[model samples]
Target: MHDGIVVYPTDTLYGLGGDALSDEAIMKVFEAKGREYHKPISIAVSDPDMIRAVACVDELAEEFIDQFLPGPVTVILPARTILSSWLTAGTKKIGIRYPNHEIALELISRFDSPITATSANLSGGPDPVSLDLCTVPYDCAINAGPLSGIPSTVVDLELREIIRAGAEIDAVAAFLAQWS
Candidate 1:
């Protein structure tokens, strides 16, 4: 398994990453970004079963996963057995993303477990969208050139609400509306 926090391109921006299961690795991401523990860190899972293993899955979640995942969207759901408080702060919910980029998938595949997917910047700084403007502010950067420059849409499954609208809102909205 890969050790230490890594930097990489993501759909939203460059991401600072680490093993989702390792408390030390997780701490590195927070430290590298000067991020707070109060805000939950998002995790990236390449396999559907892996995601199902960590986050409580419902029919709606499955539907959304089948449709918008491997794209620009993060689905926030109730945390499951494998997810630790390190990833979710003290909350019982976790945010997950299955990015569309091949490089992202390859990195996740290599890590075996889910990896943290926080924007590759300090907590209150501007996110780097292109490699020219990107800086490796973490332990390592799993380079994949510039990213798509669009942040993922964030959907809250517990509240059944769209927290942030991005490029995939229309598609995401239709998928959620079906449940309501």
Candidate 2:
């Protein structure tokens, strides 16, 4: 879905995705979810190269990515100048996800760019584990049945803290414990 938001399945939950670099696509995503501009949205990348392109990944962040990626984890790091402030909500940091699911990975790989990885639901609504659960409007959808019903465990590598606990939290905690 070029320049349009799509509903796609991830390892944890269904997501509303659009081109992360396109302000038009990003705004459509925001409108679909009714999410505030101040609240930043996470992005999904296909691999480490994409991650490096979007964020300023340091040694610690690299270790964290190596330890737990292609799974249910979102790593927050310093944003590169390429990303728009709207995408980062005027913050210097951005959250990234490299999902383990095949459909999600393939989508990003084919798109050749990062896409918004926010849950496909109204802001503050329940997790979207299945197509029916998603309330946000999208141009198209890739149905992969139900997901894990859990969101990714968001970790801020710069702050070295878990922003929000979700899937695979124990492993994330152990990783943080070793570093912290």
Candidate 1 at residue 136, lDDT? 40
lDDT tens readout by residue for model 2, 24-126: 9999999999999999999999999999999998999888889888999999999999998988998889999999999999999999999999999999998
Q: All models: lDDT? A: 0.82, 0.94
Q: In lDDT terms, how accurate is model 1?
A: 0.82
Model 1, C-alpha of 74: deviation from truth (Å): 0.2
In the range 1-180, model 1's lDDT, one tens digit per residue, is 355877777777777778898888888888877888898999998878888989999887888788888889999999986777978887889999888777788888987889998888778776678655544466656666666677789999878899988869898888788888
How many residue pairs in model 2 have overlapping backbones? 0
Top-lDDT candidate index: 2
In candidate 1 the C-alpha lDDT for residue 110 amounts to: 80
Model 2 vs truth, CA RMSD? 0.7
* Clash count list over all predictions: 1, 0
